[model samples]
Target: MSIPLLKYSLSTQNQRVDGYEVSPGEEQPRAYNTDNLPSSVEMDEVIWAAYRQIFSEHQILSSTSDSNLESQLRFNQIRIKDFIRGLVLSESFRKLNYDVNNNYRFVEICVQRILGRDVYNEREKLAWSVVIASKGLESFINMLLDSDEYEENFGDSIVPYQRRRIIAQRSKGEMPFNLKTPRYGADFKEKFGMPQFIWQGPVRQFRPQEQRPKAGDPALFLGMVNDLATV
Candidate 1:
């Protein structure tokens, strides 16, 4: 049997060393964050972009010059975005951000669905729900819009639907992981067969490489949505 050597800090530049090196350079280096954030906020953006694309595919965010679509995707988007921001700024993601294996896995399945690829398997469904548990309402919205498969299926017009679908999902019961042991980290392995690692302090004393956008900001958070509107 192949042993899944757990890679700590899989979301950051200075990922923990497993038996084998993960990938060359930062191209595929595992990401870890004291903040438990996924490496490359751009990946996170892809999640949101996929959500928007899927929502658009559903026509959940469509609007006429006169009236809005029957589905309320805008409200959903706002609530979900707020939820994601809150999760990122939470103690869990901040003090010792662990990898969101189940969350990421779930999003992958959802993205596939948006692309009209094979639907989510049973485990995949659980993974999708785990995303909601990790980041709450915001994840719901972002996952829908930021999926690459979604972009492949629904070209352009992803932004508006992203916002709308979020509202719809929320109404259907998607929120935070309310627990008495709030300090306990969410489980990634049991949920999605990913290796789990505790959030220790920063990886020794290694510093992260700095990256800057050339033209205009890459457009993060609400800015991304606004940029979408402009497009």
Candidate 2:
């Protein structure tokens, strides 16, 4: 069952949101995960096609070359879906897709891009929403990009595309992702990214210390309780 999250909170042992610990009330530096890892372009056509579909809303950066993107994929062994995820989450993508959208709506649009289909149901919708709320957008995107359903549909090599839209008698209407509607009206055009209701929930449980002792340390040999007692 999904928790009824009203707001989101970001807390860490380190002030850094990326993964760090610091004294409370002290500001921390942020960690960035957008490093350019080496990748390959042996299958350029397949890779490009995936990029087009997943990053349909994003324009290719003047600095981003086809070769660079190819290498990023091959070297990292990044799944087609994950590549799409990187694009969807990229600063370029966030500006276009996430701007002027709220949580429910943002989740719907991302699902369309990554899954190639509208969400199956509300339970599905809330599940993803809570994720975005709790972990922020990047983690939420990772969940869908790495889901079993996604793997089953697109696998590691195949690029993500729209899924089956017609269920014969069971469902109807065109795919929402294909609709020509604008993200919002003039009043809401200023809204950038999801609403607060989806991004401010408190962490369920906080583990302030993530570091473990060295392999041969007495703490390691003594186990967790003994180690903490000594500290």
User: Pick by lDDT: which candidate is best?
Assistant: 2
Report the lDDT tens digits of candidate 1 across residue range 1-231: 422222222131111113243535422212211122234564345344433333223222223111121122232333333333333333433232223344454344333333333223445445556656755635564555555544453444322222122232344453211111212234554656556768988766654545533466554355778879998
lDDT of the candidates, in the order given: 0.36, 0.57
* Cα RMSD for candidates in order: 25.9, 22.2
lDDT of 1: 0.36
What local lDDT score does residue 199 receive in model 2, on the 0 to 100 scale?
A: 55
Per-residue C-alpha lDDT of model 2 across residues 1-231, encoded as one tens digit per residue: 545433433232111213222443222211112233313343555565655565553444543334555567766666555666667777766765667666777787787767666655666667677878778888788777787867776666566655433331124544334443526633354464434444566668554566655567676666677768988
Q: Model 1 reaches what TM-score against the true structure? A: 0.23
| Candidate closest to the true structure, highest TM-score | 2
TM-score of each candidate structure, all chains considered together: 0.23, 0.52
In model 1, where do residues sit more than 4 Å from their true spots? 1-118, 158-231
